[model samples]
Target: MAEGGIVRVRHCGAAIFCRRAPARCPACGSPLRGAGLPAAPVRLPGPFRHGHRQPRALLLRPAAGTFLGGYDGRSDLHVGVSSSQGVVYNYDEEGVHRAETGWEQCISIPLVQPDMFGLLQQWDKLLEEFSAGEDWLPHRYDEHDHNCYTYALAFVNSVLTAQGKQQMSKSEFTERFVIPRTKQASRYLTLHQELTAKDFYIVPLPDGENQG
Candidate 1:
């Protein structure tokens, strides 16, 4: 696999999207010696009509600790995050959608920098503090070009917080993320409408980006 890429796992006759790394597998009992992370839009447990569209959001692996999925070509909004450890997760639109955890339960968190749950917790509160709050996340997601925006931003800020690259009040964070998304929605939405479900995925291979 390339330095930052994902691969799909054919586990128990099912596919799972995983973040790629140079060493070990975060999913099942395995190592990444020759393994890679799968691409997005994978078929996992979901609420929507799922056949093979890129996920709106990805949930964190209990082992990967504090991370989630990444971008796909289908998204109007896009981001690529890489940790110093060479771990990478692509946050695309659909992956974001799949990342939902209802009011009562939440995913297990790992020892992440800055904070994973903290940012999520903060955003949850910020949404309540805002004017248009009902299903605000789903709306903001629709306004953007992809589904992965919420958690991607979370990943970015968490990485930044860990690295001391940036900081912001809740308003500042919202201002920074929302403006670009609202503005760029016109650009990526058409792409989103055109691409089908299969368009978002690719098995991460050694130097895979250069191949067909």
Candidate 2:
């Protein structure tokens, strides 16, 4: 009989086929060998590797609002860095300032942990440098051009470029990063509005007081 072909035994009246070499027959206890069985399956490794580390947290907060008696709809942009402790740095009509944490919307971007602390330190140093200028002044709000959104774009791009990452332009940052991630109520506001509008600036909470 051919290898792995079924064989009928007259004595036990049973059919037997051996899939592996030297296998015992099920009905008669006789040894048999077969050569036509399929090979075993191979197991591939899993998608995720063991002991893989997760990326560090880098939070981006984008906020929008209308200042008192400015407009009916939200029409301003503010960006915040959560890497700093207990405060968000933003630029407004009053120029660059730090406020207690209450960003209207936030988006977390993963960054290399090793560089996070250094980047934050650089951010603080930049602010200090601006403060030390002989002609130090807050960024003035321009109706059709320079505004909060412009400040955010410049600040974020500066940090990104310093870290050897790709720098984003004002339009690119707004459309790709800020608009897509911001809340719906404030998402549609653009920098090129024909009518001028104002944005409500955040006030620092008193010491040891929490924002409600």
Q: Give candidates' CA RMSD values in order.
A: 15.7, 25.1
Question: Candidate 1 regions off by >4 Å?
Answer: 1-150, 187-212
lDDT of 2 by residue, 1-212 (tens): 11112122111232221222224434445443331232111122111111112122223433443221232343343444433343455555676565553542344433335656776456556644543443224545663576545655555666677779898877876686545445432322221121123221122344444211
> For residue 59, what is the lDDT in candidate 1?
20
Question: Cα RMSD (Å) between model 1 and the true structure?
Answer: 15.7
- lDDT per residue for candidate 1 within 69-104, as digits (tens), equals 223323343332222222333343233222222211
Clashes of each: 32, 1
In model 2, the Cα lDDT at residue 189 comes to 25
- What is the TM-score (0 to 1) of candidate 1? 0.21
Enumerate residue pairs that collide in model 2. Answer: 95-139
Q: Provide the lowest-lDDT 10-residue window in model 1.
A: 102-111
